[model samples]
Every structure is written in structure tokens, then in C-alpha cells.
Target: MIPEPIPEPRDAESEAQPLDAYSQAVSAVARELTPRVASLRVRQRGREGSGSAVTFTADGFLLTNAHVVGGARGGQAAFADGTTTSFNVVGTDPLSDLAVVRADGDTPGPVTLGDSDGLVVGQLVVAVGNPLGLAGSVTAGVVSALGRSLPTRSGNAVRVIEDVIQTDAALNPGNSGGALADSRGHVVGINTAVAGIGLGLAVPINSTSRRIIGALMRDGRVRRAFLGLVANPVPVPAALRERLGQRDALRVADVVPASPAARAGLRRGDLVLTAGGVPVSQAQSLQRLMFAEAIGRPLQITVLRNGAMVDVIAEPTELDAEHA
Candidate 1:
């Protein structure tokens, strides 16, 4: 219960403290979410604009899906209180399906990012944003799944591994880049995209965003690490499973020449049966491994090439920074 307002405390020192506890609770939660409940507006050439939900950044930045706000010919943003303002694209990461947008003049307060790594399946979570242009909307759900692989708009698939929290929380189209929070309302993920039945995907902003956002704020771009190779993971069909004696493997689709994979002697058509002793079933299993690994550290890779198993180690390198 909120502490009753004892008619102005007699002590002058005590009078300095505000005593509306109930109001404090409501306002605190609102203050935590209001800045992140951003609106994304885009204008393409002469075409009349469009908008979506976004999140405000810690340092006057706005975050959203790259596709929604990155390539806009003209764009703007709206925060709480109907404050509308112009914006510019700082940088875009199509691979991760994330982008950093910036507004000039002044920006509202930012949201505190929560740890996505600690997100537990079935734990309480909240999706706070303006859905379908409705301002200040909050939807609640429990974490659904942890490791998941989501397809990307750039045709390169995105695999969220290790605490890639899933929730039945309804995330509509406009909810992209809005805050996905824990019960305490700390942001755990950015509402990026939605897919089949209760399965919405988001990019974990914990460590990745820490790096990207810093770079974007300073230079309008992020220097990201990339390993130029493609692995096609095919699940063993239920009927065919018995013959293989194992669940799955990554069938190497393509390898970019001079890439870490190529430089390390990894070949196309190799089946990645294991990664660091973890049995690989799908492409995401490997992608997840990559994301979890240190940027410059060599990874122990196990593959089946022409029915023979091979082991090799390769380090991940940075992706193009300016092109974003």
C-alpha cells in the first residue's frame, strides 16, 4: 500500500521527500517505457509517408528495423505527447535486421536495456510499444523459447541462440524496435519481426547493440564481424532419421574465397556434424555458436566431408562498416 500522505512532516528535512507512493509506481513504469514507445515514420521520394513503433536510444538515438527506417528518402519520429520531429538514418545492419536512427534538436530520455542472456523460458516478459499506431501500448507474455533461427529480409537468415526468448506476447508489425522487457520493465530485446503462431523474433541488443549503438552514435556506422560462409542445415526427416544415427548436420552450401572458412581449408559440401562438441541439427545451431563465440577467437569446427569427419578452427572477422 502506498504510504498515506501524513500532512506535511514537521521535520524540514523530511519535507524534502515526496510521499505519493502510488503515483510513484505508476509514473516510474510510465517513465521507464514512454521514451522507448517511439513512432517510426518514413517517406519514399514523393510517396506519402508510413510509420511504425521504435525505441529511443540512450543518447538521443532511435532504434528500429533497418528495412522500416534505413533507406527512407525522408523520415520523422514521434515520441510521447505527440512531439513530432525529423530524423536521419545513422546506420543499418541488414544482416542482424537492426538499424540506428537519429533525431536532431533534442530527444526524450532513453530506456535502460535489460540482459537478453538471462531471459528464461516461461518467465514473465512484456512488449511495450505502440502497436498499429496506438501510442503507449503494453502487452505481456511469458518467454516462449530460447534458441531460435529467424529468416531475414536481406535473404540472409538470422539465428538467435542462447536466451533468444520467445513469447506468446502479441507483436504486430508496427511493434518493431519497441522494447521487449522483463517483468521489472528492463529491455531484453527489440521487437523486430513476427512469424508463425506465437513466434515473434527479435535481435538481442545486449552486447551487440552496446557495440553497434556506440559506433553509430559516434560515426553513423558500426564495424561488425563477419565470417563469409554459408551453411545449409537440413533436418533429418523423421522417417530417414533412423538410418543416420544422429539428429542433424550443417551441409556446407557455399564458402567465400579468402574468408576465414576458406583460409582455414573448410570446403563446400562439408557437413558440419558438430560445433565445439555440440550436436548440430540446423543452420541456426551453428549461427548461434558463431554469435556466442568471441569475435577474434578461433572456433573448433567439426564437419563431415565425403563421409569422413574433419576438424578445423577459424576466427570470425569484421564485416563492412561503411556500406551499412
Candidate 2:
């Protein structure tokens, strides 16, 4: 058999083109976001902690994780442009792990907030933050998954921050509250946790979070409606699934004693089909309805109990921040 001829070496520039494009994308995102992200140093109850924050408003408002500035009166923020400012904590919602602050000094223009609901798996994302106390650090990665849940608690109230973005971006100790931007440099999520090596989690920027941010900015706190029930998603019965055009419903796992759910006759093992006339499929489906508007409002809920349809009216109460 004749020996195969050797193939010519591939062109170097062509070989590196893909990597160079990726580098350019990451570089552009970093340059656009670094100046808007700040290294934060906060003191709470005489204990100091450090993290990162992102400028989200033209009038010096910044957004960060609630845990970052927990019970702190104010903090110092240092930007990548060599400018430093003092910021006062506006509000903190521990259930969502989101907080807002206003800088006492000038700040860079706010980064564009993108809809995290539009992000898809495998999409390119760039993380800009002060990881390890090093300012202006940038890391690139693809979204590994979507709709992950991060459980949170405030006093006796336990909730899940839903639709969290999961990525493989390299995050570290100081990366919390940083910007997780998309390819076009829109802030899609806020880096919140390092789940493991190469696994990072972000609180998605969506309508629900927007409401929380707005409440924080205006009221210094988030007011939530309390239903007082624990639920999980479950497959809907075949007959009802076809009729409702939905595959899943929320299964009531527990109901707090004397709570609105219990008062409204909602019980464990009930499959919730709709709340306030909207289809209920996941915990978030019910959570999204538990905002300020839902408080004190009569909510009509439909459920499947013992293979029969049951309707109940629940009047949710305003969740007390101190007791929640």
C-alpha cells in the first residue's frame, strides 16, 4: 500500500479566528461593564464584608445582592475608573437576595438591563466583577441551564428565587452582586453564588425582579403577599391537562396553620390548576402573583381535589418584613 502524503499545515490566522472573535466579544463586554461595576466594602454591626455592585440608574442608584450589604447602613464603592463614592443601602429583600443603594457621588452611566427571560441555554455570557478583591476581572462562559431555583428565607418566611440563570462562568468570593452581561453588553443577571467549581448562579433580571427593584427604590422594602403554602410542580391529570392545555399543576405540600390558604379551605394534596384566573404550573407561577397588588385582594383559585374540581377564594395578607 502506498504511504499517505502529509497534509499541509493550516493557516495560523484562520486557525485562531474563532478564538479571536470570542476574545473580542468578551473584551468588548468587559470594557462596557467594568466602569459600571464597583468594588463594595460594607460594615454591618461592626463586621466588615466585601463584594461587587453594579450601577443601574443614571441618578446614582446601584444594585447588589441583599446578602452583600446585610444590615449595613452604608458602604464605600470604588469603580474601575479610580473613583470612589459612599452609598447608602436603600432596601433589601432577603427572599429575593436583591438590594438597591444610592451613591453619594457621581457614577458611570447605568448599564442596559436586558430581559433574562429571553436568555437561552448555551448563550454567551460575560461576567464582570471584582473577583477575589481584584477589580475589573472578566470571565466568559455559556449559560449551562435556566430556570434553576435558589431557596431563600427571611425570618419564618421561606421562598424560592425562581428562574435563576446557571452558567459555567468562573466566579469567586468577591463576584457577588456583579454584572452578568450578554454578548451585546446588556445586564441579564446579577452574579449571586458560586455553586461549585465552574458552576455559577445569577439572579435573573426579569419582570419579577424589576418589581422588587422598583419597590426597593421607592419604598425601601419589598411588600409581598402571603399565601402561606408550600407547593411543587406536578403533572396534571390527563383529562384536565388536555382541557387546560397545560401539562403541569402545583401540588400543595403543606399549608400554614391559620394562614390565608388554610382559612380558604386549601389543604395538602390539592393540585392547584389556576390562581387569580391564570394557569398555575410551578412555584413561580404562584409566586409571581404574590406581589403587592395581590395583597388584600380576593384571589380565586381552582384546584383538583380527589378527582373533582374545587374553587376557593383566598384573601392574602401583606407579609410583615419583620415577621416574614
Candidate 3:
């Protein structure tokens, strides 16, 4: 047999290079956050169920989905370190699908909250939680969409969780109430729903949600003011933009009969430019202004009607089960 040609000297430069950037980022996040996630076993109607929760405070305050604990007051939280603690529901806001629970013992350090406002589509995100009762589970994906609305109802109160984060991470039923963290391990959203294969939804952790969390911790409920107007985002005309300084506005799609908007003389096709001196571009902007403090208060609404800017004073009514 012919002698094999002398193998060329192995070149180190030609060696396969490892691309571990993605892995490193995800692993770092998982390492930091896995400890703060908890597997919750809740008892409801004589049946035991499991869900995930994130410890948002060092003293054992946890944030979870209201639907997960649905009508239950107490549960057990198991952490990654095999420690378990009894937790009691502090409050629940079905409209936001968020609930706060206080655990009996110490917990891992609270996660740092990140601003969801800065999130962009295609940003890498990591989901950490207990899924299908598998505690400390982790998944990685990109934010596929943003500014989504999740409609919810509690009794007769119809509400929408606006600006929800949509990701491509695989979410299971137990993933509800878990953390949807960024590459830096900051919690940007709370995992809420599994829409379809590779599709997940989270409640964005922004100013509005921060307020909701504070309310749940303090008052055990969130008080909201209702303006009975169906609106859609629309661009302000060039002429209107120069006067209002806003490029986008909410166009009144339908004014509820005898409701606040109707009472205030708001009509169909009215382009809402501002509410209470704040720019009204999307529904969430108005929702942010409709806190407990705004209830029963005269809200100055500026709308473009027939090419003229008109101010309408509408007193918001407290949103209740009987009238949402």
C-alpha cells in the first residue's frame, strides 16, 4: 500500500471556534434567577394544584398569577434549594391577573425589576419557573411581539391587560406567574399565558404594573376609574399634530350609551388627544391615568371634533361589578 502522505501540521487557527455567547447569557440568568422561583402547591376546592411564582421581596413576598391561586387563600412554596414554606395570599386582582402572596419563611433575594418600556422585538429573553410541576425549569427565546392586549373580565368588570409582552418561549400551564427575565437577569414581565406552540404572553412589569403591585401589597385591591369609550389608536392629522404636539391619538370607536363619555358629550370619531393633561396615544395611557385618585374626579379630555380642539370634562365613575 502506498504510504499515506504526511498529514499537514494541525493548525490551531483552523480549529472549530465555540459560539457560547447565547449559552453564557442564558446560563447566567438562570443561575441568578432559579433560586428566586418557587413551585406553588395550592389547594382549591378540595383539590391540589401546582403553579409557579417568583419571590419579589426578600422577606418572602411572591408574585404569581391570580388564576393560579384562584379562590385559594394559602399554599406551600418550594424553592430550588429544597426549602419549603407556607404562603398566604395577600391580594388578588383578577383584572390584571396578578396576585401577591406572603410566604412564611425567608427566601432568595428579590429579583431586580427591569423596565419593559425599553424592550424591543427580537431581544433575547429567558423564562424561569416551574412548568408541569418541574421546579426551577428554564427556557430561552426571543420577544416576538409587544404591545399586545389581553382582555379579561372579573364579574361584570371588563378590563384589558394592555402592552403585554409576547415571546416565543415555550410556556406551559405551570409557567403562569413565573418570571420572564432579560439576559441581564432583570425581571421584565410575569409569565401569564401559553397562547400556542412557541407562543407565550407575559404581563409587562412597567410603571402601571408597578403601581398595581404596590396597591396589591397595601390595599389588597386596585381601584380603577372607568371611561365608557371604545377607542383605537390612530394617527393625528398633520394640522392637528402641530397644535397638540402628539403624532398619535385615540379615536373613539363607540361611545357607550349614557356612560361617562356620552355624558361628557364625547361622540364617535372624536380623536382624543389628551386626558387630564397627559397625551392619549393608546388605551394604556388612559388606563394609567384612571387610578383610584381619578375616580369621581373631573378629567379634562381634549378631543378633535370637526377639525376643532374641544375640551370635555368627564367625571370618571368607580368601576364596579355592576358597571364595568
Candidate 4:
């Protein structure tokens, strides 16, 4: 009893000390995003599924995952404010794992979308979702990594969703399509998957994703240009690196027969320096250009072949969904 000294009485200031800067930031984000995120109950072919979604537009439009509403024509959305509404699927892009839906009733104001391209590793992030059917669940974590690729398949076509954000925030099955907000409460990523116990992944909100979302909202589908080729990033020659001011270039690993790259005389072992006047260092650099606007458009490419710079013009074709 003598060893257990009397403890000092806690004051108001001491009681408030537990809410530190990190706690305050996370709490603020939860307060801001909880109302905008909704718990979804979707019905597809008589099968019921549950997930989360976030409001991203003023007129009751919400953003979610393609897999969340798979084959669902419409569903119910329940928000944290105890309001529920019916919503219809506007469009879905499996290749990007993104879907847009419109609510039939009033909803909360949309969250501010932030550019995920500006995110750095170890930055604080807040995740708001309805995990395990618990509405308005919030978790705090940091961005563990960026530029992670997630492979997606639609029918027989396969593609990689580029520049995905990886985080340590706890995500469950029902957390799919929820908002992964920054410390400032801006929606930077759409939580899409629980990769492992301590790992989660999100679809980043960037220029490329914005283009896909716009296409989904407007055209009910996304159209992409296809240049059939496989490439790997390789270090540019020291001399070329100095002259071109770039450290890496894409090395053509394989060229599909009769495709745009092959038609343009691009062959394996060619080092691609630029495409459409933009430096080509990674697959995403070229993938970002493969949109509807680029289909059937002349794409100028510069490559290093046998130590000589070669220029070639290629007309990309619309990617067929069946074979993309």
C-alpha cells in the first residue's frame, strides 16, 4: 500500500490532453466523411450483397466499385443520418474497378475529391466505411505505398489498374467502395480491397481515374485505344540519359503481330523514348494516353534502335472489350 503512492487528481486540461493532434485530425475526418458515406444493399439476380459507397456529386450521384454492384440494376443506400434511398447503376468499368450510381432521393453533399498523385508514403489517411454492416465505421492509418498495380479482368479481357494506393487502414468486405480520405478530409482514394490483415488497397483519384469516371457518368462505358505491345522499363544509356534528361525508357519486350506497334515497325529490343512528345518511362505513361480521344489518332513515337533515334507514327485502334 505504501508503494502505491497517491495519484494526482486529473484536471480539465489533463482530460483533454488525450485528444492529441493525431486524434483530432482523425476525429475531424470521421465527422466530415461519415455522413457522406452510405451502406449499400444491392440485389443482383436475386442474390443480395452489401458494401459501401461515397457521395461524389451534388445531384445524388455516388461512386462505388464495379464488383460491388455486379449485375445489379438498382439497390438501396442508407446513410449515417438514418436516411435511405434507392439508387440505380449508371455505369461500371471493371477494368478500373469503378462504378457510378445515381440516387433517387436526397443525399448528403459530396466529399471533396483530392488528387492522389500528390500523396506521399507515410501520409496520414482516414478510412470511413460500413464494415461488417456497421454503419459509419472509421479507421485511421498511413499510406503505406503508392503506384501499386491491381490486375482486373472483364470477360476474357485483362488489364491492370495503375497507380493504386496501398494503406495500412483496416478494411473489411463491406468497406469496398468507401472513402479513403486524407487528414484534411478530402477523398483521395476509393477503398477497394483488403489485401491482407494489415494491408488495404484503394483506387486512386487522379487525372486518369477522373477520365474514367467522366466516361462512366456520361457514356455508360469507357472506350480505350489499344497499342498491342509489352514493354519493361530499362535504364537509358548514360549518354542518352544526359542528352534526353531522362533516366529510364521503355524497352519493347514483345510486339503483337499486325497491331499498332508492329505496324509502326516497332520491334523487340527497341527502347521507346517518347510517345506523342511525352516521355515514356513506365506502362502507365502510355496507358494514360489510351483513351477514346487517342483512338484512330496518329501517335508519334520515338525510339532508340541500334543507338539511332527512330521516329514512327502509329494509329491506335479502339480496344475491343472481348479481347482487350
Candidate 5:
């Protein structure tokens, strides 16, 4: 066989400019997701506010930030293609900063939701939303961190949103309630808050958030089980970890008087290792287990105390509005 001829390399002048890997990924996602984002015009208490929303269902349900709709009964959702229609608030969960709105007329079509739990730090992400009243704006960045906790207050009840997605994507006030998409164009998070320059947070679209969204759509509200306890993450000792198969645990910092934990004889300095027979390493895990369905139910919580394990039964109560 004849020897293969060497191919000549093309000159720089003759070669076409190529986009980088990140640019290509973002461009592809933006093209598929921009059309699904909606610019919200909310009028509440004689004041008009603007933000972004994403259609979460085919029958005209939209997901947005509760702060964006602030006391607004109805609003207009303007799509990128100029389709504007009136939408009424179905429910609002201020503790999670999520709200559901239903369009009076046509729907913008729902977006493909991704598993935020699968996201890793340094993963590429694209944000699509209406920022500062600009429709269909797109921004790209990498996930800066994970497992962030955001504090939210609804009336006198203060709660923490766990597993919040933190990114470096440039976000403005109007970007709240927008879609944070993965490389495959699936929405992994709902943009929620901006901390500082180059820092943004989104509510992860995990099982917990999905439950809240479903409750909002069906019951017009999310009713959660209240467990009056404040805890912080602490490392479990090697001996205790081997016994419980848990490396870290939540240390009880406070127990409200007459609360479920208090009534169950849980005290401060106790390290919580399991709830409802499942291992729990974060406060959010306990919160997730305390859904509305669990109200008035006996929950078995195992704790590590003084190098020993003890089990207690807590009767969770319905979370009232002022304390949810």
C-alpha cells in the first residue's frame, strides 16, 4: 500500500472562528429555553412590579417568586413571542418564596424540569429570564457552590430553604423566579435571590420543591408539619458514626417551650442522627419529612447523646400561618 499523504494544516486566516465549549452550551440552551420564559407584570396594592416566571404546566400554570407578586391577586404574563395574558395567583408560599399562577387564557407551555440534586459544583448553567424588563434575556455561568441555606420569613414564621443552588451567573432584581437551566436545557432551579456581585441563589427543583408546587396548585397552599426545633450541623464522632453509619449529624441548639421536640424530651446539645427511621444529616431533611401529611403523626427520631443512642417519639402538629 502507498504511504498515506500528510494533510496540510489550514492557515489562521482561512479558518473560521469557533465558539468555546461554554459558549456553545449556553447558546444551545438559550435558544431552547428563552421562548419558555415569561415576563410578569404584577400590580399589587396600587403598585406595579415586574419579574420573571416559567410556565410549569401545559394548562397555564406558572411558577414564580412570592415576593414578585406581593399581595397581587392577578397579573399579566408576557411571553417572548408577544403573547400576553392575565393570570391569577392560585397560591403563595412566602417561606419558600414560591408562588403558583394560572393563566386565564392560553398557556406558554411547560419547561422540562431537571433534578437539581444531580447538579455539581463547576457545572455549566444558563439563566433565562426577563431582567430589568428585558424579555428573554440569557446569562451563563458555572455553579459556584451547593447545599446553601436561605432564610425566608412569612409573617412571624421564619424558615430556612435548604439545598439552595448558588451560582455566579449575573442576576438582577427582575431575574427572580426565572429558570436556571442545565446544559441539556432542563430547568434545575428557580432563580430566587441575589446575594452580592456575582453571587446568586436559586431554589432547587428537588422532591421537596415539587411537593410544594403540587400542593400550591391543588390546595391553594402548602401545609407543613411543625417541629419547633433549631439545629446546626455537627460532625458525628467516629465511634458514633460507625454505630449509626452517619458521618455528620444535626446538633439541637434550641427547643421551643411546649413544642413537639420539647414535649418529646429532646434537649439542646443532642445530636440528631435519624428521623422517621431514616438517617438525617441536615435540618432540611427533617423539614422535608415534616410534610402536611405527617401532621398529628408520631415520628420516631433517634439522637446521639453522651456517646449513646436514644429514641424519642415526637407528635408533629399542623404548621400554623404565623409559625410555618
Candidate 6:
């Protein structure tokens, strides 16, 4: 066999790079992602805040938080080129806090989607969007934590956001549903909830969002099942371990009537052990499963009660705009 060719050495043809390369890179990414953003000037039936949504799909499709575009009887989406177009709400999923809109004009393609499950804490991340009426804004920060739970503003007590990626990424109001991109310009998370303080919150585009996106592109609504229950993490405490028969699970506060849980016989004082065979109650794990689950697919749920194990089948229903 011919001797293997010697591997080429590292080329020193590198162009001049400045120390402010970090700032430069941020600007470059902002430019690349911003042309895709269109301001969501929603004209709601009721009083709703005006915000922005970024473009993710070509063919005039855009992505935004459900609350941002929800309940809008009429609206206009404004682009950076001073061109504004009328848009219609295509889909909304409060569980995932995402909505898609289709405008009457050409839409730029969204950033490349990436694997959110591979994100690491302390990794550098950047948020690009219009914040507080400021356009073409970008902020940088590290992944503060993963697997976070925040209550819904609806207070329906039926919904609790889990697996939220916490970042000090300096996000602001208009950033909702904008692209939280990785250094390589791949989309990782959808900027969703913010503390309304200095803290920023985003939902990782786990396999779940991907499916939702595909479905929304195909249909105007996402048909997924839901468990009519108010849930909170069952934190492992020294006292609860003995009194509650702890199992690193989610404690059920309330369950919906005539829901999959009620049909499958889920009751109070029960702890959810797993969702469709994956561990439940860990904010991240629960989120990952819900995100990946197909709407209407019966879920095999493992639960613990009085130190005994039980199972239930729960199917999610379609998420509709009128539900808001």
C-alpha cells in the first residue's frame, strides 16, 4: 500500500483577528438572524402587549410565544426593510408557549435547528432580537442552569413550565420567541419567558418543539393531549422522605375531570414516577418528554401512592387559539 500522505499542517493563513472579536462575532450573528425578525404588532380583541416574533420558516411563516400572538383578531407584522405585511395566526401551544404566524409576504428561512439536549451549563450563548423597542439587539451570557420550572401567568393551575433553560443572557420584553442561537448560528432554544427582572428564561427546542413546528407547518393547529392537573416538583426534603414516601417525583396538587388521568384512575396524593417510561418530576426530564410526545398519543404514566406503584394512560389534546 502506498504510504499514507502526511496530514497537512495547520495553515497560518489566518486573517487578522481583533481582540474585540467577541463583539464582532455577536454583531455578525445579530445581522444574520435579525433580517428574519418581524415585529408582531398585534391588534388584540382584548388589551395585549405588542411584541416581536422572529422568522423560523420560509414561505412567510414566523415563530413567537403563544401569549404574544394569542387572541389577536387582527395584526400586522413589520419587517426590517420598512416593509410591513398583514399576518394571520397559524398555531399556538400554551403548553410549549409557542405560536406560528403566516404573513402575506416572503419570509426568510429560520436558523438551523440544533440538539438542545446537548447544551452544557456555563457555555457561552447569545440572544438576538428586538428588546424594549430596540431593534437588532444582542446580549451574551452563560447558561446559568437547566431544568427550571416557572408558573404560568394564566394561573390556570393546569400548566407549569418545566425544563426552562435559565440564562443571565440579558433578555428583554420584545425578545420573546426570538432565536437563542449557539456560537455556530444554530438555533437551540426559543426565547420564551423572562423573569421581568434581570433574569432570562427560554424553552429548549427539545425534540418536542421540533415536532410541533413540523405539525404547525402542516396544519394550523397542534393536536396534543393534556393532563388536567396542577403540578409542582416534589423536592426531596429530609422530612418529606418519611412522611410522603418520596420517590424523586412530581406531586400532584390537582387533576382535571374527565381527563386522561381521571379516566386512567389517577388521584391525589400520588407522585408521578415517569412519563411514557422516562423519569418524571425532574424539570428537565418532564420537559424533554412533553416536548417530544405526539399530541393524542396515550402516555403510560408510572406513579407511586402509599408506597405502591400505579400506572395511567393520558393523551394530550389539540392546542387551539380559542383556548387562550
Number of the predicted model whose lDDT against the real structure is largest:
2
lDDT of 4 by residue, 1-324 (tens): 458877999988878756889999999999999999999999878789989999999999999998898879889999987889999999987767899999999999999999987899999999999754577788889999776656555565655555578899998779999999999999999999887899999998988889999999999888878787677667899987888999988888777667788899999999989999999786568779888899999999999999999999999988775434
Q: List the residue pairs that clash in candidate 3.
A: none
List the global CA lDDT of all models: 0.64, 0.87, 0.85, 0.86, 0.84, 0.70
On the 0 to 100 scale, the lDDT of residue 246 in model 5 is 82
TM-score of each: 0.65, 0.80, 0.81, 0.80, 0.83, 0.73
Error of 5 at 240 (Å): 3.2
> Which ranges of candidate 5 are over 4 A from the true structure?
1-16, 228-235, 251-270, 282-284, 304-313
The weakest ten consecutive residues by lDDT in model 1 span: 154-163
lDDT of 2 by residue, 1-324 (tens): 999999988887868745588888998999899889999999877788989999999999999998899889898999987889999999998767899999999999999999987888899999999753577888999999776666555566555555578899988789999999999999999999887899999998988899899999999999888887777777898877778899988888777777899999999999999999999786668879988889999999999999999999999998765425
lDDT of 6 at 291: 37
Model 3: runs farther than 4 Å from truth?
1-19, 154-157, 228-240, 251-271, 303-313, 321-324
How many clashing residue pairs appear in each of the predictions shown?
4, 0, 0, 0, 0, 9
Q: In model 6, where is the ten-residue run with the lowest total lDDT?
A: 315-324
Give the candidate order by descending TM-score: 5, 3, 2, 4, 6, 1
For all predictions, the C-alpha RMSD in Å is 9.7, 5.9, 4.7, 4.4, 6.4, 10.3
Best by TM-score: 5
Question: Residue 275 in candidate 6 has what lDDT?
Answer: 82
Candidate 3, number of clashes: 0
Model 2 residue 243 CA deviation (Å) reads: 1.8
Worst 10 residues of 3 by lDDT: 152-161
Better of 5 and 6 by lDDT: 5
* lDDT by residue for model 1 (153-238), tens: 23343322222446777877577777777766677787777766776766665665556556666776655555655665555446
lDDT of 5 by residue, 173-282 (tens): 79999999999999999899996899898988888889999999999898878777777667888866686678877888777667788999999999989999898786
TM-score of candidate 5 relative to the true fold:
0.83
